[model samples]
Target: MIKTKTLFTKLFLSYSMIIFLSFTLFGLVFIYIFHLNLYDDYEELYDFHYERLQEQIAQSAEEGWSDEETADLIQPSLHHRNYNIFIYDNTGELFIQPEGDAEYEPDQEIILTASDEFVSEGATMNGNLSYIIADSFSVPGNEETYVAVMVFHDLNHQYQQMALMVLIPFIITIAFSGGIIYFISQKITAPLRHMNEAALQLATGDFSRRVTVSSRDEIGQLGDTFNYMAEELNSLEKMRKEFIANVSHDLRSPLTSMKGFIVALLDGTIPENKRDHYYLLMKEETERVIQLVNDTLDMSRLEAGQIEIAPAPYNLTRQLQRIAVLLEPQLERKGVGIQLEPEDTDLFVVADKDRIEQALVNLLHNALQFSLNGETIRIQLETTGDMLAVHVQDEGKGIPEAQLKHIWERFYKGEKSRTGKGGTGIGLSIVKSIMELHKTEITVKSKLGQGTVFTFQLPLKK
Candidate 1:
């Protein structure tokens, strides 16, 4: 619901309101000024007509025209202009009608009559123009017989036009103002839209997307800041993954040797027949401790980028055979058979011989741990184009689906499958790291209660 009020809508509304109000105010002012000008024209026309009529009447007196003759000239002027002219005697009685009705009572007439103090009354008559202002002036020579002149100015039609002019522009300006506001808001908020999209992508874990930096404005600066944050997060994530991998591998080696030696010693391999048996047991424990220390140091060096891999062409088949020999005792104790699958014995891969052998040894030992007696742990080698894949497969209870992904994670164990099983949970992690260093790939395939296979592939020398 909140998202509905988008930037566009807000911008449009805000700007539209401002424009609408400004236009409305301007329109009202224009209409006021226009109406005032229109009224001024009417006032000047009325005054001119009144003064001209007085001149004509004075001229008629000089030319010996009667009041009736002067009234004839004024009568025509008032005919089409919606006005009435009249003359009143000293007693304010009707003397002549310029255009039409002259029998109006003094109270019913809108007379602009003047004696010493000019007086005028406004009246609304049904057959007339509904409003009247009369001007009166005394006939110069016949002061006793003063002349009263009445004029009517129709205000209704003028007022109606003024109102229409005011209302029309007001409506049009409001609409135009609203449209302008919308356009301006969209222009101003364009950068924010880009920033919003970038933020959404970042929330979804896409740190690769960067906000668009289009201007030197504040919104552009915000975009730059967001992009910088994404860069930092990407770097941090990389470091975190490296740390987990290093910690996992560093813990696997010694734990494997320790469990192996402890099992052997407990199985009476070191005799209870001699005190030297205790010394041998102590030596085995010391070796386990030493192996653990070395693995930790190696992992630290690798993560620190201080270690270099010296890749060379090495016989991968021979390497697997050596690991099988190394773990032969452990395999026998676990009652598992070790078998080397038939392949090109001279098959070679490009890698650091020592590192590859160590990796192969870890893989073999890991497979042997889960295998029972008479179950074959097969070591197979395959070549695809320029890659050499060595697979360590165990016929022991297969890895659970839920544990496959977590198997390479440090200190992670399948909740149900890990109980009572002795493992440092770091062997596969080391296998992963070593393969990464070699630019190799490792994969696993297993079904519950069926069997498990771990495959590590290294690039082969062409």
Candidate 2:
């Protein structure tokens, strides 16, 4: 199998071929037009000379000069660089021969009785292609006594000279054009080549590689997009490594605690009275482990599109009130009051009720964990146009501005100390995924040391 050519090579070859063919065609046309023009000028020259010779013959005949005088009179006018002149009498005899040694004998019968005023024909003489022109003139003294002049013009030398003159410039033009075209093609494809190299590096797990943009054209835009993708992949690679480390740490901590508690109870390290307490501690650690595993599985399923949303009409306000009542014990323990500020009208929305409830639980739990004692957690529902917006506001230490953007990413915890606050760091990610499944977006507005508000909109049932 033959290997294919590179893009640069193909472009250069195609451009060069086009230039070469164009120059070849133009040269052919130029040569053809030059040939025609040369012939026209040659015929005109012969006609002019023939007319001058006739005037000279009329003058000689009017003055009654002899044949020798007439020949001398017309000789100067008959001389030409590219043509040989012969004059024939009415009796088909040569009257004036050319001044130099002739290569072939002139045809007297053809020259004298030629019918046309200007007759041009091709003849082979002395192994070369030659052009012959014949014209007749009547002497002023006698109308019947006429003289016919034949001009033999050799064309092989002129054609050879013209070919040489046209071919040299044509070759030079093709060479110059090919060089310029190659340079331009290289400039055009340079970005694509860099992008190809960067893509290869990325495929090999080197996400740091990037392409340099040199133009504002489509190829440059492609290079920019490639660089952006590489940056994203690099960020994702870092996140993946961090995720693995976080998972390992979270898993190991719970397993190690449970292992220690079990060993202490089994080996009599703890007093008999404390065994029950240690067992309870082990059970709590095991529960934490189970929660982590469940959250991880939920996130995986959501991201893999394995979870389907079943939407239906449900009362938005009643759902929030119910979640608050259910979490009344936890909220009471923390001294955090639940405030439900819903619209007075029965606000119904079309969404997956179970998924929305899960999202609300996550957000409410997050608020409860962060709220200070005696602070109020507000669950507000407001109607805006055809959408019903829900807001979960916590009067707790707010998230920093820098960490706000990454709050919805899996395993991204803004407060490291909140790891023990009953969260697997997958709650917000789950909520975000659920909201996205409903074709809506979750938004957060927070400032450090103030409070955080989590808002999402749902379509109101018409």
Candidate 3:
């Protein structure tokens, strides 16, 4: 597998490269434009000087002045400026050459090619690189013409300054852009970094760690989700510990009872005539242990999606009546009566009949555990729209409002004091899992000191 760069490095490099390329292209274009403008100004300045000299020569030619007098009129200005001025007659012969150690020879072909417009060409003058601008002009009131050629040495200095003007600001802007991009990238990734750390802590079983939500953007929403997940994991961890402790206690209590009874019988502590009574008690304890193990296994299979439900059309009323009959022994033992209220017509529901019956048994068992003697537990079935609603309501001391939401959780017993209520504490969880598998929901409405109702809806057979 190939290693990749960190998010911070990637973000910084990506943003920085974008800014750098943009500024660099802008700088190249800016320098090109600036250089063109400078070149235009230099051309205009040289053109003005060339025109002045042409006007002087024309005026002098109209007056019929000698070449020496014309040089005297133009030489002073030529010396003041940084150019080597050369003048030629119409025949392409050298007319005037500026006083310098530089040697020159004027070419007739070059002079004839020159026009009123300035033409620039490279040349070597006095052993240095030089640029020459040449043009031709006609004398006023005279048919004679002359060509003017001006040579400038080292003209690149102005272009160098123009490049510097473009480059300096570009460098400064790029540096400033780099700083801003780094800050922005950090601001964007800071929340993610915190979430990464929180994730690591969570992986290490630190469910209590939560991320800080600093903004109301997507990252902030992610942080909120992460915190919510951590809270759920923390709750689940607590419930897992409680489940293990409960299971151990439930297993050990029955084994300890069975052990004591067996030992008493084996050592003849109880008389042979009374052995039958102790044998029954030991059998009940063994059954209790078996019941706990079966409930635990069933819950695990249900949660692991291992239980395959066979859905078929079944009479809802008959299923409820059968469950009530099955639990009648315990109900009668507690002096509790079950009231069945089915709809007038036979209510057929499409569901896994066995699983639905199991769910009803769990719900009724829970109600029985909380109900008082002679209190009637109502099993009501009603039709709402196209769905059938089954409610198992108990007239027991109702569950507290705070604990109502947690009752469906595995191993969540509402009353810790009633720990020996003949349950594995996972009955309601199994009920909830069954209902969910049927693509429905179960709801409970309870008021403290009032009655509690556990209602679930199932689809009618199509």
Q: Give me the displacement of residue 220 in model 2, in angstroms.
A: 4.4
Q: Candidate 3: where is the Cα deviation over 4 Å?
A: 1-4, 77-85, 88-93, 101-133, 140-146, 150-152, 170-194, 211-221, 259-310, 343-345, 417-425
Per-residue C-alpha lDDT of model 2 across residues 1-462, encoded as one tens digit per residue: 422388888888889888888888988998999878877887887777778778778888789889998888877655566677777776667777667736645565566556335567777777877777777778666664555555555678888888988899988888888889979998988888888888999999999898888788888788888888999889777767767777778789989998888788778899998788888778768876786787788899999999999999988888877888889978988899998885356789999998899899989988988988999999888889999888899988888788889889876756554334434567899999999999999999997777999999999999
The global Cα lDDT (0 to 1) of model 1 is 0.68
Tell me how far the alpha carbon of residue 37 in candidate 2 is from the true structure, in angstroms, after superposition.
2.4
Local distance difference test values of all predictions, in order: 0.68, 0.81, 0.81
Pairs that collide, model 3: none
TM-score of each: 0.48, 0.80, 0.82
TM-score, prediction 1: 0.48
Q: Candidate 1 residues 1-462, lDDT tens each?
A: 545489777767666677777777777788778766755664566577667766766677678887667667666765445555556656767666654554333443334235344444455555433333355664466444445555554555656777787778778777676667767777788878887887888889887888768778787788788889999777656645654664455456545666666776788775666647555665755666676666656665766778778999988787777777877767777788888876446887889998877677777767776777788988888888888777888876887787788777654444227334644455677778888888878999997676888887888888
Q: Cα deviation in Å at residue 459, candidate 3?
A: 2.2
Q: Cα miss at 424, model 1 (Å)?
A: 19
- C-alpha-based local distance difference test score of model 2: 0.81
1-462: candidate 3 lDDT, tens digit per residue? 322377877888899888888888888888778757755665676789788987898888878899899988887766424466778878878777777624544445567777545476766655655666788888668787778876666456655667788788888888898899889989998999999999999999999898889899998899899999999999888888888888898899989999999899888899989999888888878887887887899899988999987789988887777777878878998999999885346889999998898888878888888888879999888889999888899988887788888888887766564334534569889999999899899999997767789999998988
